[model samples]
Target: MHYLDNLLLNTDSYKASHWLQYPPRTDATFFYVESRGGVYDRTLFFGLQTILKEYLGRPVTHAHVDEARDLFAAHGEPFNEAGWRRVVDRHEGRLPLRIRAVAEGSVVPTHQALVTIESTDPDAFWVPSYIETLLLRLWYPVTVATVSWHARQTLRQFLERTSDDVEAQLPFKLHDFGARGVSSAESAAIGGLSHLVNFLGTDTVAGLLAARAYYHEPMAGFSIPAAEHSTITAWGRDREVDAYRNMLRQFARPGSIVAVVSDSYDIFKAVSEHWGQTLRDEVIESGATVVIRPDSGDPADVVHQCLQRLDEAFGHVVNGKGFKVLNHVRVIQGDGIDPTSLRAILERITSAGYATDNLAFGMGGALLQRLDRDTQKFALKCSAARVDGCWIDVYKEPVTDKGKTSKRGRMTLARNAATGHYRTVPLADEAVSLDVADAPAGYEDAMVTVWENGTLLRDWTLAQVRERAAAERL
Candidate 1:
């Protein structure tokens, strides 16, 4: 991982240590005391406790023992923190709760409750439901996924530019570079993971850590630019060739691909005069490749011209089919490239005789920080909520067929047998029963038992989570 290791959230990197200190993070020690009146009403105590446990991924640690607080039931005593902890211990990590939802990669529209949570404990029902809105606050939206889906489509345009029947995998990596730019740590990690699921990227490495332990999957890594000590000097025509040759020699290798931030001096002259010939032969002979990243200039023009330079070098670098020298120096593009910019650049590059295989686009700010016209470039919505003592699915109904419209109250989202995409419909009352085979999944089933008696049931490695999200994307 090119990014920092360990968790940005309160979670511990070491699972054992995290479990030992788990109680502090769960509600057993703190009842989210503020929202008490709103969520923990008189009739829904048990469900609230359950919801807290689920969210914390652990059991209630300060289990109250004095249960006769409601001195109405048999041997009922008001339980203290210890007593409640005992209840959690006795039940192990298995609480009678259920949650379900569309798999991570599923695209949901506005107003749709994507997941639902419920339980057998009547007093505890709405309590856990309190977190329903909060959880999806992180889950639903995938700016990168939405953008990446468009990214994949956009990339196809680049590939199609070349007349070759040769199919090429995505060369330029799409990274979840949104963490520092996100509102919260959890949101950043989960949002990054969502993109990884729908596209290939390694933004929130912690999500990868969780995914890997939860589900065995492959994780991606970024090749970071090195700079223990860095210096930049403006170059004139005289020093251009030497600067290009030196940098090219420094990073090129058999399996290594080096990207030189071109445009340091004279953008076009520097490449054609200094880089084009020597850089091309080295990459081809060394069985490696070189990429030119012009940070300052119009992306479309620079990329188009960069391709033309590579075309000029192609004739000089060829040796054999696989061993062919840098006959194809892919245009490594970045500066000021958003989805719109990406489309324009690809269109221009293809028109100039460049194959996507011979080019890669690296996007940073523009793509990572795009805004939504719906006033939500991407937002996680509460798809379903526990209302009127029962859980119901929800979705967005297009009111004016304009922007985001109606919020469907209770609905079931299912993949049409004919089409893999989801189709939203009403959730039946029969789903309340666990044994109902056709019961549509809800937020309750999606709730995985992470903790027990203030102890995590098992460890989930970030690599696991990253891997799972990656596989889900495929």
Candidate 2:
């Protein structure tokens, strides 16, 4: 017989020992997690189901726990011996926690409960005790989703101003080139799928796999054969025009898109002379859209310049919105695009009388790994705990930073009466009520039961998540 070690079992080795400690007579504890609203004003709720599955795989059996126990004991049990002992004592081989969450694709305001976790059995206190460790991994995917969703919103605003059909162009406007730039294969997977939740263009196969594995999507994203500097410069600087032509010759199938890195030597010469003059007729006759990637220089300035050069070479078409789109050519600015630069590039193009659809963007590090927990101020704290069979409201208020203050008691995510906006109301709030027939008219419970001990209650597909994300703008 052979066994595969649970490699992910050591993910939370850095947790404090006090997490393993509870009151002597404690029966159970409830921990609620939220974003608390950070650098970004709003939070797009995502990735709860995905992260839960990642941390706790299908039917964690006794063999899995035995492997984890063996692995931990061999490593000298660095973090806490007592915690491992308690896990062993309580090990039924499956996680004993119940996970309740808002729907995976639901977009709610930040500082609301994204997930609430607690023990499933009244007798076991350690069931949901690992929540602080388990819940931390969720912050990254959620932040990435929020950032990418905002990028989609930003692109939609500019596209709506410049084109009549915003939906047709939105999916292809932002491409993911961040696979190689991310920290690990898993990072690429999480960050890549997060971006694809709002768009359809991607090069990250790992992210596509994540969508298939976690969200049950048959196809999550699409990309075309594209050129890099090495592919072009390998043809030598002298044969740059030949190299540009070769990309089209190779990938110029009907209705297909081919991207060529045009800034190999001189971006201006490549656009104005090579793609513009030498290969202009071939590009137009090939029945393919030629995408030119500007790899260097100031992205906003260089992209606009590339668009203008393409417009001069390929000619221009004025859409119904009266914005000019260069025919047979488009610019993909992949060099230095974050959310800030992306907005800048679009604004420059639109203000310069060019359509936003004239160009697209490919983001790398900024798309995948360039975020911190505070990007959305995510924090998971114990809001209510049962002591002596009485539910006690737990909270922390700090004098140093009022923003660091945490919410108290059980939280009810409900719509405001007058404003009709979703807001987190504490159980103690005079205007708030829960789990009753006479609850406020506008208040609807946003949180739903997603996971029970060793069983997944709800499953979502990638297309469904995309639909929920698109609804955020509407």
Candidate 3:
């Protein structure tokens, strides 16, 4: 019996996320053997599940097939299940010795292999190295978790300026709309899960599936004919109303989220003018509001202008006449968004007399890629070094501090009590002073464990990473 238990589900133990789902779906099982370039991404399920199961000390239930021998099912059709079983029988008990990473979800800078493995038993390890492509497939989640904190900050800044009414009437929404923005399926799924911890919408159904499977959280989904993409893009901007209304009616989804791209023509006019007021009314009257999307121009200016028009046209939604706003329609800023641009837009929108809560951010390119052209939010690197063998890490040196070498051996990582600064102590020789109650706020240690034993230790939900980032004030 493979009954799953949530024993290690506590905040510090397993990865805790906001859009947390109860159970992770095991749609499929894969074995990613380790190699020189990278370690096995899926090699430690046996260890992890075993450890977790033992901790629970009960009947364990989970979805997975033991593939220590041959993998007839995983190879799919044409491999012949019989042949696969034979192959598995021939290779049973053959595996290399690999060390798991120190901690999961810890930031590892560029150049240092996130997860590394070397076989104590080379013969066993040799067989697994043949599967690099498979292992990389699972790297997306780590990659997404890699940058989850930054995305959270962008949302936090926007949420800070929200007003009581706007927040009361409209909701603050963040979405995992990064499928098209990512390079591969694994990346999309993992990144999607990482973000789902805090955001509200995901355009990719696959992302939702992965979230349900891994995090077990139900996330928001996006529907097509969204503001009737075909209609709006097909016809002239002026025809947006008729097209939008027709599409909204034809594909009327109860409590549907209909986002109208306002920049099709004149952005200002699009918001101010009552285009297919009936459709807007439909959304509002139906208790759902139309979501306005601005895919062009300055998001700040557009949002400010849009809010003013909504207020003028509807007349203080709190009143009977103007108050007819249920889902009167909120603004969602798309187009180009980076951390800086996001910060700028949020600040500008707030200063322009609109509550940040009234709008949503649909961050696409910026959230997915780390590009030089766009703003650089943070740098992940192997900043210091721990000496070879029986290594001890030293951030400070008694001699030439200029060398700035890292003390390495095994390490003990802890938050400085008084100062709240992050520091690392060498594993073997424990002889330095690391405690400080007044470590000064704002300074925190950065080396985080990204991978170990070809497995991922930390599976941070979007919210946890985000909260850490917020408190760190990055």
Candidate 4:
């Protein structure tokens, strides 16, 4: 590692000795994560393997401690011993947190154990005990996946009603444009790949790299060659047609697709006059799909207009389902698209006598940055603590806010056989079986031991996650 890399490792100055008062009992503290499920009924499990492999797997080296132990000791003041010992007892300097949870890609119902964390060695309880931040980090990708999963569900509903081949078109319907809109490159990677769990289209380069690095998938998402307004407008309005022609020449090949920003000047004229009439023959003969993107305007209104105009210019063909599709042309509404607007756009296009296949939606800021821990009401709390060989149920029932009331005791998530809904059960449940399929009549454990100590017990690739995420029972 470079000197700078080592320097960066000891950067968690705030978390150093911050656990001095946590757990209260120095021997052991048990904690588990759950989503209280305010806005979402369930959360799609994702990114745990990524978090473990990327963050906790890379432990703080002794060298990192040697360089910055003094500052941490000073920051801790009277608790300097806490800081010093963490470095002195470093075992490959990695965090000594052991985690157990449902398998990654499992669609866990609300108020269930996402993961439970405790110190591996009793003496090192403090090492993993101060975990508000560490445990909370899982919130991002989980929330992203949940939101994207619901979006996929919504699109699937529309596709089922509107498209003949719902399965074929669902993946490409929602594309990730969230790379530049997120807080960092890492966020782009995690959040982008989370969206890819449900759908395959993405423009976030870091997301693809993240999938390759963390999920061991060489290619996690796919995108078409596309142009932005800067490239289109740079050609000037007078040469707009030339720019469109050049994009087609450079990117459009047989059985290929490319997107071009058509709203640089008048989106209507560009769609109707240029792409519709003037370049109609080229578009028809090019044997490639030219996707027109409207970068600005109300998505519902603008995309509805684009679909009708494009159908007029390029002509329309009815699929088996009787939905009109423009020949060699499509519309991608990227501006102001959220779940609400996405559904609205689909509704408008279908109501305008076109199929949901007539358009795709691209989401940027709303897809990644517009969420928080409260988006799904995520919380990690001590539900059980082991003291002197006895297990005690632990929880907080904050009267000030009933919504903040947390679950108590050592809990295991299990699928209730009668309703097929997952429910959190006390660990002592007589019928609890870890394997859902093998479990007897009443209950099956939904939670699986995914991580133990520093070893990742179960690993999942992007394809595996996509498959598991698609599986209804997982």
Higher-lDDT candidate among 1 and 4?
A: 4
Worst 10 residues of 3 by lDDT: 26-35
Instruction: Write one digit per residue (lDDT tens) for candidate 1, span 35-141.
Output: 10111111100112222333545433322222222321243322233323434665552343444443444434433334444443432332233233444333223
State each candidate's clash count.
70, 0, 43, 2
User: What ordering of candidates by lDDT runs from best to worst?
Assistant: 4, 2, 1, 3
Clashing pairs in 2: none
**With candidate 4 superimposed using the best TM-score fit, by how many Å does residue 40's alpha carbon deviate from the native?**
1.8
Worst 10 residues of 4 by lDDT: 428-437
Candidate number with the higher lDDT (3 or 4): 4
Q: For residue 89, what is the lDDT in candidate 3?
A: 48
TM-score of 2: 0.91
How big is the positional error of residue 300 in model 4, measured in Å on the Cα after superposition? 0.6
In order, candidate lDDTs are: 0.44, 0.77, 0.43, 0.78
Model 4 per-residue lDDT tens digits across residues 1-474: 565454223335565555565545556666778898857788998888887787666556556565555555656532334453564475556555567777677787787777777666666766554545665779999999988988988888887887888889988988999989888887898899888899889999898888888888898889999999888888898999999999999998889999999998899999989998888899878899999999888788888888888877888888787788788999888899898999888887787778887778899888999999899988888776666656677788888988888778766677665776777766642122255454446887767666665677778778888887887532
| Per-model TM-score on C-alpha atoms | 0.62, 0.91, 0.57, 0.91
- Tens digits of per-residue lDDT, candidate 3, 117-208, equal 23232122222222232333334444444344455545555554354443332223555556787777755655565555444466766667
Per-residue alpha-carbon lDDT of model 2 for 1-474, expressed as tens digits?
Answer: 134235226356544234446665567666777887776777677777677677665444445555665666676553343444444456544566777777676677776777777775555555555547656678888888888888988999998899978889999888988999878998899888888888899999998999988999979889888998899999998999989889988999779899998887899998999988889999999989999998999998999898888888999989999999888888888889999999988888898999887888998888887888878888888777667777777778899988878877766666554664776655543222355454466676666777776578888888888887788763
